[model samples]
Target: MTNHKLLIVGTVAALAILVAGGAYLSGRSEADRFAQCRTGNVAGGMEAFGTDFTLTRQDGARVTAAEVFTRPSLLYFGYTFCPDVCPMDTARNAEAQALLAGQGSEVQLVFVTVDPRRDTPEVLTTFGEQFSEDIVGLTGSDEEIAAVNKGWRNYYKANDAEDDQYYLVDHMTNTFLVMAGGATAEFFPRDTPAEDMARKVGCFLDAAS
Candidate 1:
């Protein structure tokens, strides 16, 4: 074939491939389309990861996961008394939330204390304010907290110590990205940077939308 004919044939083939790919994507379900946004895998898959639970908010009002997670939310499990790790992790989440906000994406920050004994509504309200005023701080009875923890598969234990007031609690430091309907979209490791978390969350949000 002539060079002009060859060029024309190549263009037609490219267009055909593009059309086929677009059709394939359009035929996929919403979950399949958003699957590309996933960075890591959960043990039993995302559907089995998160569950709804009732807990008290910073304002001392009882609320459920569905109510607090009315939008894309960063859910964390930690304590106000945590000397180092919790503070750093929550600060990173706040930073990520701010980044998303600047890019026109609104996400809620949820802090569920593992040390409910010391993290009352008043204490949580003060702790949450140190990061973001809009942060949702949740605490509840031991049973309620345990149920929520079990639903999320969170591991936390209080240390055996002589001084109960100053004792530290051992807990997981992962931050979960939960969608509006209580579906856990993803999770970030303790070392994940704010920018990286924001970018991943943004990808998920875009895919979901």
Candidate 2:
């Protein structure tokens, strides 16, 4: 298999193990609080995945996770220069966001760039608008971006290209549903359909409410 396929398979396997281990250790009965909303298990429940960090918005203003995740948000990490995977994955997220809006559930869409050196705020802004007006594109200094990536446990590696402006980033493609206060409700893989994503997100929203 190619490196990209191998990376995806490895990530899925790792997450599956984490989820299973967390479920086993929690020892909670099936009568959990968000039990009805959960279509699948999370590693350690709602708070397993997210962390506190700051990033620069497309407008070049710095914002904290608290400010960004004021609502149920779909958060993704990718670069604007990514040739194909990032575009398609983020478009899928936008479609899911639209579906939720039509059903009267508002969700924020956040895209953070992993390639901070290349993805300036202006570049990110243009890229995000191609997907959705409400999409909040974010980039930060290299240190800041690395911190957030570490917090989210996402992978990203930039290739050493002869042309600095043209390069590809290999990164994970998991879209996280993070609620207010940075608690992750669920995570959707790259291949999840928009319809399924909308349904699952609605379940979390309803259960939260």
Candidate 3:
């Protein structure tokens, strides 16, 4: 009789567990959750806050937003030939990465090429390694670059007259702070202090979790 009772209890527990797990997954997939995340972005409209983008990583591997979708991602748009703004911003991002590491916070850094024409896969892979070990550089065909830029709300322009002599990219200098999973949680503009950037990322990760 004890064996019979034990078997019944175990079966009932398994059924309950399965039912609860299904419900939880269903609730998370509901459109409302993502919709709320999208609506919150419209006031100033955080471009990094939205969902959708996959770029080539610094190691010559393709990275999708889905890969880091559950982690915080700091995104920047620039080209390797950038003389000033890009380097300064990327350096700051590297500092932020170190700060986060010291604080035990998890974050991912992404660098998307604005001058894909010249920032080929080989150049980006080599140049990106010089900035930071954790920074991921991405470059793609012009059409692919344009689609991703629009999705992320990034801006870029090319100069034609002197294009052959010098790099012809003038991209936005702002850095995008994106929370994994939830689109457009917040943003840090160009030159945000490393300490402040780390704090914001911590808060976003905590709240997002």
Candidate 4:
């Protein structure tokens, strides 16, 4: 072939390469947009709340953190005997779950007891049933509970009980919304309204889906 013919062929090949490269990049950009794999970015890094945990479920079943967080979930840290704050907060969470269920949303609620000594699996099972059958009440050894709490950056302390009849637990009053696969999480105050909680959880579900 003549030199001119070879030059024309080379130009066509280069153009094809550029077009293919552009298409690949465009496709990758779209994938990244929808992935949303890590949204919990902060001053340090994209790390979010507790990634995984293991504890005894209300029914005395040993469940891993991975199992519980398979879908979008709401986690509330409190004990069964919490007289005022815990009861009220858990009740509110149950109401919010009801609201979401009405809209056909499938978000799970998890109640983790910071006071593990008195809140055994049996006690947690009974306490969780009072709110909703869907709630998973969790209790673990003191070390296990503490490790989980540290992962969540939550704090709690046991107050004195009179005659060991009733006790108070001072704990963080924040509930956490963990996205599917436990990749990200957001915090909401305990007093967050049911409507708002439902709306926010719906948004997270929509995004995850």
Candidate 5:
């Protein structure tokens, strides 16, 4: 009878373990969980945010997403005209890239303008040079810019100005660190220090090599 009681207890314990495991799995967000290999992380029952795009490079050539994201890249979306936030954020991103370079990881810094009308190729090229000559400044038609922005879950709003041509654009400032495979593997908040950002990026660069 003692042996029989022990078996019953063991069975109940096994069932409890199974229930707990199921609960843990069910509670996780899709992005928080791992899925098949074709896509990046699977979150919310869908692939995580990395997408392909075609836009005009600052050099006046049309480039596809794969071409731009060919290597590990830091993507920032803002207009060159911003008096403050965009410049500061972009400078910080450039600093992080320099930090990564110091550690032997070459990460491309690609700046995409949300204000395409005002940010022509020449304008973007000049603005980008102020940060780093290596930076790739991209501008596209309005439709192309909107599509890429939507895919990346980035937001920008043009504030009303008496002269619409000189309006201010309020945009999201998170820097997206896309892995080599063209998938948005990580994102660093605007406030993240260069050292901290480099440490996070190094993890991926290390693994890639």
Candidate 6:
């Protein structure tokens, strides 16, 4: 074969590889963009609050964290089907609740489900109440769910091709604190200890009041 022909063939192969590489990279970047993880730089992070939601409690009564707790709010984002992280987060939230209770700190603990397909209103009702009586689980439509996720910068996706199977919600495991007047103040990541969170809440309340 002529050297010129060989060179042309090699160039064609390289171009093909470049194109394939570019496609792969694009897909990977999209995946990473959708991924959500806890904040590590600061001891506590901030909430990306979207539009406020009015949801019914387990008892079929309308409520919001602000309307119910009325003091300060600690919000946890997770789903019911979570095998490990969700339960751990709830337990940690409960621990924080207990710590605050021990200190007589009035803090509202709220749990929001990222995967609402399986974690319907009923699922949320049961899952949240297990941790603490104060814990409330709320549900909304897909659009509302997406809006909340975007507002909070949560990472989650449907696990199955069909809607029957539960979805996997990937979100920053941060407890957002909504101080007085439904304003977001600070947030505690999963790494922070429950005791520290309780203390922070106490301090915030003391300063606010």
Q: Taking the tens digit of each residue's C-alpha lDDT, what string does model 2 give over 1-209? A: 99999999999999999999888767554235567767777566656577788888999998999999888999999988888999999999999999999999999899988999998989998999899988888888889998888878899988856757687888999999898778887888999999999999998888777
- Please report the candidate that would top lDDT against the real structure: 1
Candidate 6 per-residue lDDT, tens place, 171-208, comes to 67877777656766667878888887787777766656
lDDT of model number 1: 0.90
Alpha-carbon RMSD, candidate 6 = 15.7
Residue pair clashes in candidate 4: none
Model 4 reaches what TM-score against the true structure?
0.78
lDDT of 1 by residue, 1-209 (tens): 99999999999999999999988877766557668888767788777877778899999899988899899999999999998999999999999999999999999999999999999999999899999966999999999988898888899999947778888999998999999888888888999999999999999999888
Where is model 5 more than 4 Å wrong at Cα?
1-47
Q: Which prediction has more favorable TM-score, 2 or 5?
A: 2
Model 6 lDDT on a 0 to 1 scale: 0.70
State each model's CA lDDT, in order: 0.90, 0.87, 0.73, 0.80, 0.83, 0.70
Name the weakest run of 10 consecutive residues (lDDT summed) in model 2. Answer: 25-34
Candidate numbers sorted by lDDT from highest down: 1, 2, 5, 4, 3, 6
Candidate 1 or 3, higher lDDT? 1
Candidate 4 per-residue lDDT over residues 1-209, each given as its tens digit: 99999999999999999999999998877445433533344453324468578899988899998888877778999988777888888888888899999999977788999899899988998898888878888899989999889888889988765545576788898888876677545667876888888887777676556
Model 3 lDDT, residue 115, Cα: 84
Candidate 6, residue 114: the lDDT equals 72
Between prediction 2 and prediction 3, which has the larger TM-score? 2
CA deviation > 4 Å runs, candidate 2: 1-31, 42-46, 161-163
| Cα lDDT of model 3 by residue, 80-128, tens digit | 8888888888888888888888888867777888887778778887876
Where is the poorest 10-residue window by lDDT in model 4?
A: 37-46
Model 5 lDDT on a 0 to 1 scale:
0.83
